[model samples]
Target: MTNIKSQSWCWIEKGEPEKLILKDQTVRQLEEQEVLIENSYIGLNPVDWKLISSGGANWKKNHIPGVDGAGIVIKTGNKMKHIQLGTRVCYHADLNKNGSFSTHTITNGKNIIYIPEKVSDSTAAAFPCPCLTAWQSFKKVPDVVNKKVLVSGAGGSVGYFLTQLLIDAGAQVYVTSSKKHHQKFLKMGVLNAVDYNLTDWKNVLLQSINHNSFDIIFDTVSGIHATGLMNMISYYGHMVAIQDRVKENTLPAFTTCISLHEIALGAFHTYASDAQIADLMIQGEKLLNDIGNSKFNLRDLNISDFEQLPRHLAELKNNNSEIKYVIKV
Candidate 1:
């Protein structure tokens, strides 16, 4: 119902940056359930690159690559009564239209969650996927109070937010990351921030929590890399992975013996009842506000060079963690 324009980000096919398929396309006209968003700040999730480069989410056909972002509503469907025009909201993109990577995106109004007046757009961008994952995982298996929860790759955006959520709920959260984020992890309230560099990781964690015992593991990093931590989990302790499910571990029983929850934010979008997700978002917004007022550590975001977006996506795959990148459109 409003004017449309060019989008942000170009997906490449064969070479890293050779193909730009999403280069030309008119945005979708709004349907009754759809609302158009003017993307303010898009949160770069690891999947954005994986789905585009590896064709994991098949963006070659769909084109744009992003899932989470914060923005304002420039237009609303005629039937859309809940969110008014000019409202600020954060959304989990359909993955059909990519996330909010574009200057404009037409999304299902149901997927758009409004941000509180006190929360900044960038902070709202940081909340959706990670916060939803944290809510669903803990909500799925609720009985782990005072139980030790280990969040591997805890320094990442998702892990960082998840750690804060767990801590606020009184769960003993153990975290791991490169030495660089060790101090950063401790400041976020993790019981132990294990640096994968020095000493035996499992031994160090076990030694540190000798009396407490690790009962639940919240893994954001998986595959063979995190086998040692999987081995450290206590009997009947549950392990939920935010990244991918563990196929095999050195301690197969430890991984398989206990409860394993495959926590995917997409599941909520596809399968959750409206009432369930509503409660989560309501709670997520509250937790997001408590985390802090600042968006993320990406205050001095470098968006001047739009040409760097492709390189940024490549770097995201090669590196272990993410570098928060914002491109002003």
Candidate 2:
């Protein structure tokens, strides 16, 4: 074991995303039921930038920011049972704690899952946030077999995983992406791909399904187009969104009997019971195990070495690129 008393971590000095600074900080001893992971790669998510953008007194006091990370376990709390030192694992960091931007992070043993041997460290880093969110979102509609489904923001990481899950379950999955990605979605076996940027894209989507309606709608970009897409959903259908806090006209959904779910991934960790946490851990491990044989289009990631993390995050925030950034720490 390393006699590591401190770790190098990125600290948020200001609320501005570009104002993050790299610094060394003392490591804390783990609590019972917690484990320390030496992060090899950290996955970036919109929440990271959103936190820094607030630049409030709370964040200024505790500057560490990150959520997704994959690494080797170097230490375990005495009460921890299954996990051992030297296990390679990945997890979503608790929102209340110091995050995964550090070289070593402490996470609850129940939250950490083993990374599959077939999956690389970078890929493992990318799985926790998006895959876990997708898994929880799909649980909203428990019976998807042979049903019609739609995934907004299909080009995104969460949408990609959600769509794949729906498709593999025999659902007639449709997606909204750029025209360039239409064929890509088709090749992935989605029923149709609509270019959301077009003025009359709704009509195109309606025609693709021959005016049939979707039974489930998973909107990763919130419900920005929900009002317009409401009429396309079948009566009593379910809708799940990651960004439902945004102001949007969703009255039409009620008229058509659509149930809207606002999914916040943090809530799963924050409010879960002991049994629920154990179930989540099991689900996470199963998802990782299956990814090796899945047809998910997970190639060509946007990656940066530890030194370039700030610049990469700034670029990720400033640009409209669809790539998910992963930091090799």
Question: Which residue pairs does candidate 2 place in steric collision?
Answer: 15-55
Q: Which lDDT tens digits does candidate 2 get at residues 82-193?
A: 6778899999988767788878888998888798888888988988888888888888887999988989878777887888888888898999987777787788799889
lDDT of 1 by residue, 188-304 (tens): 667788887766776787788884457888777864444445656677777776678766544555344766667778766678898876776677666666655653332223342
lDDT, residue 56, model 2: 30
- TM-score, cand. 2 vs. native: 0.92
Where is model 1 poorest over a 10-residue stretch in terms of lDDT?
296-305
Clashes of each: 1, 1
Off by over 4 Å in 2: 1-9, 55-62, 245-255, 295-299
Candidate 1 to truth, TM? 0.85
Model 2 residue 205 CA deviation in Å: 1.0
The prediction achieving the highest lDDT against the true structure is: 2
